[model samples]
Structure formats: C-alpha cells, structure tokens
Target: MMILSWRRRRGGHRTSKPAFVEDNPGMDLAIPTHFLCPISLDLMKDPVTLSTGITYDRESIEKWIEAGNEICPVTNQVLENFDQIPNHAIRRMIQDWCVENCARGMERIPTPRIPVAPRDVLEICSKIMTATQRGDHKKCMELVEKIKRWGRESERNKKCIIENGSGCVLSALFESFSSISIQEHEYLLGETLSLLIWMFPLGSEGQSKLGTAPSLRCMAWFLKERNISSCQNVILVLKELFSSDEKHVNAFAEIEGVEEDLVKIVKEQTCPKSTKASLMVIFHLISSSTSSEKTISIFLELGLVSLVLEILAGPERSMSEKALRILDSICNWEQGIKKASDNALTMPVLVKKILRVSNLATDFSVSAILKLCKSQEGGDHQQVEALQLGGFHKLLVLLQVGCGEKTKEKVTELLKLLNQQRGRLDCFDSSMDFKYLKRPSL
Candidate 1:
C-alpha cells in the first residue's frame, strides 16, 4: 500500500506522480521512495539520520522528542542518543533530485545551514560579553543581534545557547543596562530584554542575579519607555524571576514606582497576555504577608482596588479569577480591607463573581467579601450595599451548590452578618428560609 504525494510548482500548480511509476501512459517521473520522511511522508527539508538508520526531517524528529518518545519511530528501538546528525549526503541527493524535476513542477530544496553548536554559541556569547565590557557597543550590538537570530532560528540553537551559560550572560547584560547612556539604553535594553524573554525559565541563581538593584532599575526604565514590547517583556521576566522567591518579591516591591507601573500596565496595556503577566506579578508581590504597610498604601494610592473591580466586571474568567485572588490576598491586610471597602464597586463585584466564574474564583471572592464585612471599616453603607447586590441570595445559592469547606464557612459567616442587619435592609428577602445558613463543621 503506497501513497501518492503532490509537489507544488512555482506557478501555483501541483503535479502528482505515483510512488513507483516506472512506465506511465502519460508521465514517466518517479519520486524515489527513500527521499520522503517515514513519519511525515513528505520530502525532507533538513534531513537528519537517527541512530536506528532512519532518516527524518529535523523538525519531525524534534517534535517526536518533544512528545516524550525515547525511541526511533520506524524501528521502535531504544535510541542510543537523541543526537540528530545532519545527513548531508541524502540532503544533497534530495536537492539534486528536486533540481532535475524542476521542469516537471517540482520546487528545488535549498541546502540547510549547519546548526550552531554549543561551543560556538558559548564563544559568541563570551565575545558579546567582552565587547560589552570593553565599551565596544557596535560589536556587542552585532553579536547580540546574531545571538537573537540564532535563538529564534531553532529550538536546537536556543537549547545550545542556554546550556552554555546564556543565563549568566543575560544576567550580566541586564546589569549593564544601568550604566548605558539614555539615548542607547532603550535599544540595547530592549534587545537584551527580548532575548531574556525568549531564553526564559532561568535557574534560581540566575533569577536572583537578574533581580538585583541594577537590573530592576533597567526594568523600571523599560516600563517608562514608549515601546510597548519592552514593557510587556519586563512584566513577563519579573513574573518568572519573582515566582516562589520571597526575597525577590520583597526586592521587587521595593522598586520605586514598581507597583504604580504595574497598575498602569493593567489599565493601559491592551495585550491580554501581558496584562495577565502584570497581574500575576502584582499578585505575587502584594499577596506576600511580608509586604509592608507602606507598600500596601502605595498600591492603594495607585488605584489597585479600582483596577481590580474594573477587571472583575469584564467577561474574562481567568483574569477575573486572578483579580479576585489578588483582592483576597490584599484584603487580609487592614489597609487592603479599608481600601476595598471604600470602593463602591468592590462589594458588588465580589457578590457577582461568586459561583459565576469557577470554584477557585468563588472561594477567593467569598474570602474577599468576608474580610471586608468583618473589618470595622465596613460600615452600614457597605453592608447594605452587599445585601442590595443580592449577597444573601448568592450565599444561599453557594451553600446549596456545595462549594469548598472554607468557602461554605465564609458564606455562612456573611449570611449571619447580613441576617442580623436584614430587618433594616429592604433588599433582604425575609420570606425565604434561613436554615441553610448554618456553618459547616470543621
């Protein structure tokens, strides 16, 4: 059972021939069977010979590796190693075959360049660092562009770059951003940040180094730049750098205007991915119990409460969930409770999002409202507003719907609080049974 494949011509037409058409009535062209990859059944662009004596395209084999296969596809034998040796001989033959069949509408395949080796990547990065240190801006920029191209060219090159101390090199480059002139800083730092984002998932040590005072200053500069890409990259890198590191989180919060800039990004940036990245960073920083009162005040003054309310009102479930979680974190603090309680929209949004987004979102929203209602700052107006916004009905629904234990507890507490004030509130429906408001046992 053989398959026939069509090769597209330069004039936007395709020509097909049987796999083994030695003598056809109308056509005589035959494509060599071995010229096609076994996996894709297509002509190989960059043919690579595996250990099991099978030749496949580089991309196909890499995808196989990425799929967690540890053996050759054709032979089903354990591969000695995953090294993909370029089959230049077979590649040349394929190119020659394409050239010969060009008149028959076959497109000629160009020769693939040898992939950059780890040693070469290491040396180029070393030269880049030396050039940067020597103030050879032109040389440094050129090498930086080359590395960027290499990183973007193939995952193989990126892996090679990362394996050969690219993290340390990037950390050094990020640190140098503070010393560069303002005119050149944007271009250089922009290029460096783009590279960093590409080669992310940095090690803990590398992350700590990159989160230094100088690198953070450079990131601050990125936020102020008119280039939106740099701003997005800054948030992404910070998100990775600050994950699970309390020291880095504290350091990041201490960056002058960092919180304000993050709030601005959430409000003004149109890219949802970047906005989420900014939100995650903000969540990590403000969620920390170690976050100072001054830090909380800074966020409040920068309108974090209003921004979160606006996001919760939107239709994105993920963003709303994240916003709710951040609200829950901040609301634990006295300052956060006061700020969220003061905002007219916070209580309403909290009540609306419960059971509307997801279980996690429901839990966080319930927790935020509970904190606000328990606070001494939550006066009659806020409490009445919650009830008017159908808070009591939502609590009853949440109890019946079987939410998490903690959520049930919070709902019960909120229901009890509202029940106490029910006589004075017109929105409360007293006709409904209140038996379901009993708190769940621990």
Candidate 2:
C-alpha cells in the first residue's frame, strides 16, 4: 500500500524505479536503483565499495570473497585486492529513504560495526598459542572464548578463523588439555571441544593428530560429562574424526564405556542432533572391518536392539533412517538376528516401515526381515509372522516402486520365503473373504 502511495507522488506522475526483489521476490516495490546491492539485488543495509569499483552489501560481498571467489560478482573481473571501503554516502541515502517512509512500516537498518579482519583472527590465535604454551588456563579460555565469539559472528569471521589455521592451535590446545584430567578442566574441555567441532571437517593434519588413541580417549572421557553441550560437541567431533579415518573406529571400539555413553545419549534423547550424531557414530563403529565383531557384541550387550526398535517406533524421520540402517548392518550376524527377532516389535515394525518411510528405510527393513526369517531353524514360524503382518503386500509395493538390485534381490527371496508358508495359497481368497465379511455377525 505504501508502494502504491509512493508511485502516485510528484503531481500524480509515477517515478520509474528499480524494484526490490531478493527478500520478497513477489513484491515489486519502487526501490531506488542506487539503494540496492548489485549482488543480492536487495536494499543495501551496509554498502561497501570494492577495489573493483563496485559497491555491494558488506555481508554479501564478504561472503563472496571468503568463499575464495577471485572475480567480483558484478564486474566478473579479477580482483587485484580484497579491500572494501564503506560507502557512507549510499548508506546515508538509504537511511534517509527509510526514514521518509517510516510511517509505512519500513524499518531502518542499523549501522554495521567494523568487521573482524584476518589480522585480528591471527593475533587472537597467536595469543591462544602463547597462552596455551604458558599453561595459563584463565587467559587461554578467555582468548578461546573470544575466538569463539568471532567465529559465531559471521561466516566471514569463521573463514578467517579457519584460513588463519586456528584448527592447528585449537587441536594443540585440545591435546594439551587431554593429558590433564577432565574433572579439573571440565570448562576448558567443553569450550575447546565446542570450538573444535565448530571448525569441523578438520584439515588432514588436524584429523591425523586428533584421531590418535589418546585424543579419542580424551574425547570419550568427555562424553561422560554432565554438560549436554559438551556431550553434543564431543559426539559431533567424534563423528567427524570417524568419518575421516576408519581406523578411529577400532580405536573407539577399544575405549571402554564409550558405547554405553553413546547409547545413553540415544536412549535419553538429550537432543535430536546429539541422538543422530550418536547413531552415526554407532553406524561407523559397526562398519569397521577388524573391530566390528567386538563392536556388535558390545552394542548388543548394551541393549542396542531394543533401543533401535524404540527409535524406529518414534515419529522422527532421519533418526529412524539411521536406526534402520544400523539394524540392517547388524543383521548379518546370527546373534544380531536373534536379538532383533526376540523383540516383538521387530517383525511388526520392520513390516510397517517397509514401504512406508523411505526407499532406504524400505531397503533396510526388507533386508533385516529377510535375515530374521532365514536365521530361524524351521523358518515356517517367522515366514508366517511376516505374512500375517502384510510383509508380502508391502514387498509387492516396494518392487513396483522399484529398489536397488541387492534390495530387489532381497525382496524377491523374501517374497518366496513368505509365499512358501501355509497362508500364501489362500492369500487372495482370504483377503476377499475378510473384505466381504466386514458386516458384524449378529
């Protein structure tokens, strides 16, 4: 409505203006051309001029530069330098424009403070390095907190922290604290772990260093801490480390009580993120080549089957997917099959999820069901249970929708297994009779 009123100004003559588009693409407002940032095509909140003679919103341009783009977004020319001069005149113009239209629900953008520079990040990292080496816990944590603030400030600040190799310093700080007892430095460990995970997908060097037994052991100990944030960060870092190198899996397997803590995180459902991370960690541990047997044994002893069944029965999608994958992975063993089959929900839940959740879920569910059926000595009872639960129908739907070759193969074998049972011959007649006999008997 304000835009319509603005269009009728100056003796009822409409002023041709460039329309604002980015934030609200559908609304074509009479926004001044000079008020917009070329990159975002939106009103510039903090206009800054680049050396390439182009002015853009500071946040947008900083993100572009930090993303390693050498050419300007507007100019498309090679950047000789990365200096952004504040466009004070343009900023003032935008502010005045907003002020003129303040009665129309237009809000003014606040002035942005000076951004953190690479030199600033490097200086703080230097202080961290020195403080860490000097064994100054107070100053070290203070500096680490400062770095964390900078990192949380913006993506540009995070890039600066990473580009300046803060990971090197942070990992060193972690190792230094690892040798110390967590009980004495719980706060320090929480802060360091949070920051380390913040700058995740650590460089190869950092990964190799942190993936060591001692580093992992220290992290595992941190898992037992009562701090929820610390547990989330430690599990996330562990996920990253395990993802980077499979050897960490075996190393983690050797750590006592680590699996218990991970299972507890899932059982208690501390947070959705931590639960998913915990499940991922377990999946990786089970996927390990050399230590998988021991890992499976430990997880089974910890009641993982029941826990996974509980997760699957919940309404969460991603967690259920991860839990199903874990179940399928573990089903290769007879003990895994026995544990899964012993649970009442295993067949019913797996059958319910077959064609219901997702393709991956269906694949896993089908695989687990096939394993359970085959694991039985008579196989008749399990097949009958599967057929009674409509596994046969779900598998047909799965085949129609299509699945992977392996999953298709598994489904085919499972269909044959269900079909060989006593109910298969009369399935069609039984279904028809049930439908026709829907009327209540008097």
Candidate 3:
C-alpha cells in the first residue's frame, strides 16, 4: 500500500503526482532522502564508482569496514571479501535509488504491527531498581547491559526501532528518587529524567516494552519517602517525549508504569504543550495496560479533548493521521466517544468531531475516522446512535461510496456493531479499515 507523504513543491497550486514506476504511494521518485546507499543502507554516503567492473568510494565504504561491520546492503552477505565492490548488478541498484528519490520504493514503506507494551518511565527504572534494593546488582547490571546492547543495535537499523532499554534504565533511576527523602526527590527525578532525555534516540528502534517489570514497587517508595516533588521532573520528560519526534515516541512505547505519575504531574501543573505531544504518544500505546484507562480519563478531565480535537480537525496529514491513531486507541474501539459520559473525558464532542472527519475527510483521514469508529464497542447502540445523531450514517455512506470494499467492510462492521451491539472480543479489526484511499473530498 502507498503511504502518502507530503513533499514541498515549487510553482504548484497543490502537488501534482510525480511519475512513478510502480504502485508504491510513498515512492516519490523525486526525493533523495528516501533512497539508501546500495552499499551501507545508510544515506548513499560519499557516492562513487570504480572502473574495473566494480564500484565504491574511499571515505564512506572505508568507515563501515573499519567499524568491524561487513554486511553489504545489496547482497545481505558479509563483505569479508571486500576485494572489489560487488558487480554492476549491485551498482545499478545503487544508481537507480540515487537517480530516483527511491528506487522501486519498496524499501521504506512502513508495515504496522501490534504493540505488546506501554512505554512507562517509572516502570522501566523500577525493574532494575528492584534488583538494586535486593542487592542483586548483578541482575541489575545484566538488565542494564541488555538494554544498552538492545539500544545500540536497534538504532543501527535503517527503519525506526523502539529503544526499550533506555526506559528500563530510566524507570530504574526514578526508583532511586523514591529511595531518598523528599528533598532529594527533585534532584533524583531530575537526574533520572535527564538520563532518559540524554539517551534520546537510543540506537533508533524508537520504542520498546516495559510491561510488569519491578517498576511499580517505586510508588510505595515514593509514598514512603514522600517524594512527590520529583514527580515534576518525570512529567517534564513525559512532556519532552511527546513534543519530540517519532524517535521519541518509539522510545516511550517501551515504558510500563508511568500513568499515575502523569496524573500526579498533570494535577500539579498546567498543560504543557509538551504534555499534549506526550499524551499523543501515551494514548497510542496505552492499550489495555493497567493504567491505560486512568491516564486516558485524566487527559480527558484536563479538557485535552479540545486540544486533541484541534489536531483531529486540522489538515496537516501527518498530525491528523496521528491524532486519529491516538483517538482510535483511546476510544478502545471508539470507547472514547462514550468516555465523556462515564469517564471525565470529552466523549460526546469528540465523537462529533470524529463523525465530521469521517464523512467529509479524504484519504488516510478517512481511515483514521473509521478506525476510531471501529474501536467503539459496535455492540453499543448508544455509541452508534450518538455518532449517527452526529450524522455518522451519512459519513459511512460517504466512505462506502468514496472508498473501497476494505473501507466498506470496516464501515459495515461499525454499522453491524451498532446494529447488533457487539464487538470482536479479541483485537480490533483493521483489515476492514483502510489507511490510504483516494478522495474527491466529500
């Protein structure tokens, strides 16, 4: 499937389609960044060619060689024999990607997957911190080293990867804040939060899991030590994670137990713009974690519904699609629509915005809307009625007429769930919901 990407163009009222060799949507034959150097799989660094039926440059190829790395991008075989470059077959592939923005464009398309964990800051640190308390520094060190190794290796990938170990380390560090007295909480939290921030894009997997580690034990430590002040720094890092880009989100996906602290942080402070971004990440990966509902409700109580809605209502496709992803997750199959009624969230109005997006939106935006609608407990007549009152039926009509059988199936299930009031007991079905669709923009 083609993932639509926006590229700035010159002398255009809007973007006209660039000539493509295939059906790849992300395949912008004009963009250079999308292409990988055939040899390193990094940027086509120091691109050059040799004459003897082979090719390579000195500077770029030399570094990977010195670093004890031998895999060649094209062959996937170890380049122990780097005697001559590969053959022209390999060189031709390099030239193609470089000459075009992305060669066949198959290399960079993102395939979505099911995530199994939350990226909680405290939960991660608590894992190792628990080991530290028990004098199992050996275990703690081992866990930390595993995290470090995972991080380094992950970052090396051409595709984004989650950096789980950093959160594990950070979660462990926050555990320290609870060990010390209240006065030390701020310092400790700061030190710990800084370590997470410092780790930044820890080797590029961009996310990891921190599920059910020893992190929860720290909350008791916090209460015992009365170290709530340090919670402020934890909020800051959470805030930073949100405002930071995709890399940060991947790192955060690894955390296991950070929701309550976010509650504590939000309760103590006004909404930081960073919180908005951080919450976006949080909402996406919150899933069925123990703390997911509480965090979702709290963000709602903070009246972030309006803030989140603004993203939903806006038209920057990247942010808009992201807003939908978060919306779909929180609604828990569209549960967020009703969250306003039972929880402190902005369910009703959020539902209205979502309906508007579905009926009037185009392309990926439509998919986002349907996903949220799909997330709703379709078995719940009230949600269907609520969305229908907001003109959701018409939106579904638009989707059926404007989109394909795939989208129609999602819309059909949404309609069915509303009609029968039953959801698929297992996981949400996205096959029915398509992410990319052509639109005349109803």
Candidate 4:
C-alpha cells in the first residue's frame, strides 16, 4: 500500500505530492507508471535502487530500512544491505517530464543530497567527543546543533544517530557539563537537554548512566532554570531514569532543592505530563522506608502537604491518584501529619476520593486519612471533620463493598474513631445521606 511522505523544504512547503496536489488542485496531469514511486505512488523525485533490484523513492526506502525492515517491499526477498544507489537516469526522466508538464502545474523535484548514514552520524559523535575533551564549547555547540538538525530532518536520521552511539556520547557530554556551574554553559547545556529530550527512551543503559548522583544534581539545577522547556526536559529525563530503576531515588532525593523544584512543578500545574512525572518522582523519593522521614521532612518544608491536598481536589484522576499516594507516604511522618491536618482540603479530598477513583486510589485515600486521624494531636477535630465530610458513611460503604484487608482494617479503625467521636461531637449533620452506609459489626 502507498503512503505519503512528508518533508520540510527551504520555504516551508511540504515535499508530499498530496500536499502539492492540495495546493494546486487544477493540475490533473496523469503521471507515467514508471515515473511514480512504488512506495508512495507519487512521481519519484529522488529514485534510488535497492539491493533487491527494486526502485523506490530514496526517502521511502530509507524510512523502510531505518524502521528495521530488511526485506524488499516489492520483491518480498531479504535485503543483503541497506545501501541505496541513486537512479540518476529515472530522476532525470521525472524532472524532464515535470518540466514538459510545467504549464499543467507540475513542479520539478530538487536534487537530493546523500541521506545521513551511520558513518556520518558516528563522525559527528566523534567530533562532539573531541570538542568535549578539548573543552571547545563553541565547537560542541555547533556539532550539537548539527546533530539536532539531522534529527529533525528524518526518522531515518534519528535512527542512525541513536544506533551510532549518539545517546552515550550525549549522556557523557551532559554529565561532564553538569560538574560546572550551569551559568558557565547555560545555552549549550540547555540545547543539549532539549536534544536529549527529543531522543527519548535512551534505553536502559543510557538511563542507568544518567541516573547517577551528579546527573541528578544537574537535573535539579535545570529544574531551577527559568527556561520552561529545560525544566520540562529535566522532569521527563528524571522520570525515565527513575522509572527504569528505583535504586537511584535515594541519591536523587538527597540533592539540594530537588524536592522543592518538584513541588513547585506540581503546585504551579505547568503541564499535565510534567506534573504527573513530578508526582511520580516525588512518590519514588519518599516511598522508601529509609528515606521517608528525611524526604517527607524536605517535602513538608516545601508546603507539599497543601499542594498534595489541592491536587487531590482536582479533576484529573491520574494526578489525583498520584497525589493521594504521595499523601499516604507523607503522613508517615509526624510533621507531614501536622501539615496535612492543617490543610483545609485534606479531609474533604480524602473522603471524596474513597471509592471515587480506583482501588489503588481508594487504598491511598483511606490510608492517608487513617494516618492523619491516628497521628494528629487534635484527633477529636479531625474525627469530627471526617464525620462532617461524610467520611463515616464512606467508610461504612467501603466495608460493605469490601476492600483489601489492610484497607478494611484502616476503615474499621477510622470508623471506630469517627463513631466513638460522633456521640461527643454535636457538629455532625444528621441530615447527611447514609443510604449506602452499612455498619459493620465492629
């Protein structure tokens, strides 16, 4: 089947024939069968012959090869090599045909340059390595931009770049630059970060290398930068690195201002994806039992408790669940409990989230509330607030509908607290609905 290939030209026009036809609809000239690219079914501009003895547009064949297809699309035979030889004869014929039909709105295809090859990508990486070794910031910047441009040119170029160890080279460069003050190399570092983001999924190995403490410190600095894209990239890179392996979390959390920057991202609600990534990273950093106390202290100091409560009250289910999980972790600390209970939205958000999102979210919500009520000094006030927020009914319904033993235990404990306090507190609204509230024989 034929597919359209899109490319950007010098003047911002697309190279796709369909786009051309859309712009010049009056041109209804029929193209010769031999003049058309077999893959795209458009007149071949840069015809190239493959090892399988078949001809296809250079861009299409290169895309196919870069996509890891080794068999000829037309011959159904295994390809011996990926090298493509330009068919000058057919290209000339097509160009001449376009000229003859120029009055009919036919446009001639420009001559094609040699597509980026694996060797070409390796050479660029070599230059970048040399420039880094020599501390040639200007040369490194130029090479990085060149590579970035090639990445933007075609998927084939991107594949070639990655396959030729560009990821490793870039990781090394980023790490080396991270040792110095970000001010010394702001633009270069920012560009490198942007490039790294574009070449995501740096595989496990690349991510592992970048998951180091130095790299994490660099990431934290990037987060503090005024450049929004740089901050986003740092979040994304940290997400990928931490998600790949959790062993890096402890070191990452220890970085100064890491938690602060992450909290800011969630608090400000910059972008949904980054906000979620920030949440997950926060969860990872504090989820560890060994680091929970210290990490929670750091987060609590940054007003994370209030931010988490606000997020739980939000409309995004995924972000809410993530925020709730962080809340559960935060409540493990005494200070976290104090900060959480002080937040006006804590009880209401937690009660509303019970049975509201998913099983996991329900677990987090119930656990967070349990921790708060049990640990907080003014337990009576929280218990009263829980009842006022219909938390008692929700707990009753939770027991009736069933849940994990741990969650049920928490519900039973919290329900007992609420019921025990319900008698003493006259603030409970008797008119509140209890149709779904089924009292378990506690």
Give the runs in model 3 whose Cα sits over 4 Å from its true position: 1-174, 198-273, 281-286, 289-300, 315-318, 333-336, 339-406, 413-442
Error of 1 at 377 (Å): 2.6
The total of clashing pairs for model 3 equals 36
lDDT of 4 by residue, 259-325 (tens): 8788888878778988898898888888764475777787888888888877776777788889998
Could you tell me how far off, in angstroms, the CA of residue 39 lies in candidate 1 after the best superposition? 3.6
Q: Model 4 reaches what TM-score against the true structure?
A: 0.77
Candidate 1's C-alpha runs over 4 A off are: 1-29, 51-54, 63-82, 99-105, 129-136, 177-185, 379-381, 430-442
lDDT by residue for model 1 (1-442), tens: 3334342212222346433232433454566778777877777889999888899988889899889999999999999998889999999998898878776556678777778888798798789778768877677778889888887777788888888888778677667755666456667767888888766677776776687877777787778764788898888888878774667788767778887788888998579989999999988888776678888888888888888888888888889888888899889888888888877788878887777778888899888878787788655666677888888887887788688787788888888888777888765665777455433322
Better of 1 and 3 by TM-score: 1
lDDT string for model 3 (1-442, tens) is: 2233423333211223444433555544333333334454343322443332224433455566668866664445665565433334444554555345433432322222222133442354566667656645446555555444434443332122233454545554455434544343444444444345445543222222111122223332332343444343344444443444333333333443444444343333344443444444455445434334555665566554455555555555445544555555555533355552343233343444433444333333334444444443432544454444543443454564555566566566556545443242233232444334333443
lDDT on C-alpha atoms for all candidate structures: 0.78, 0.78, 0.43, 0.78
Off-target runs (Cα >4 Å) in candidate 4 are: 1-28, 58-71, 92-115, 200-214, 289-294, 358-360, 376-384, 392-442
Question: Candidate 3, 18: how far from true, in Å?
Answer: 41
Report residue 163 deviation for candidate 3 (angstroms).
11
Per-model root-mean-square deviation over C-alphas: 5.3, 7.4, 16.6, 6.1
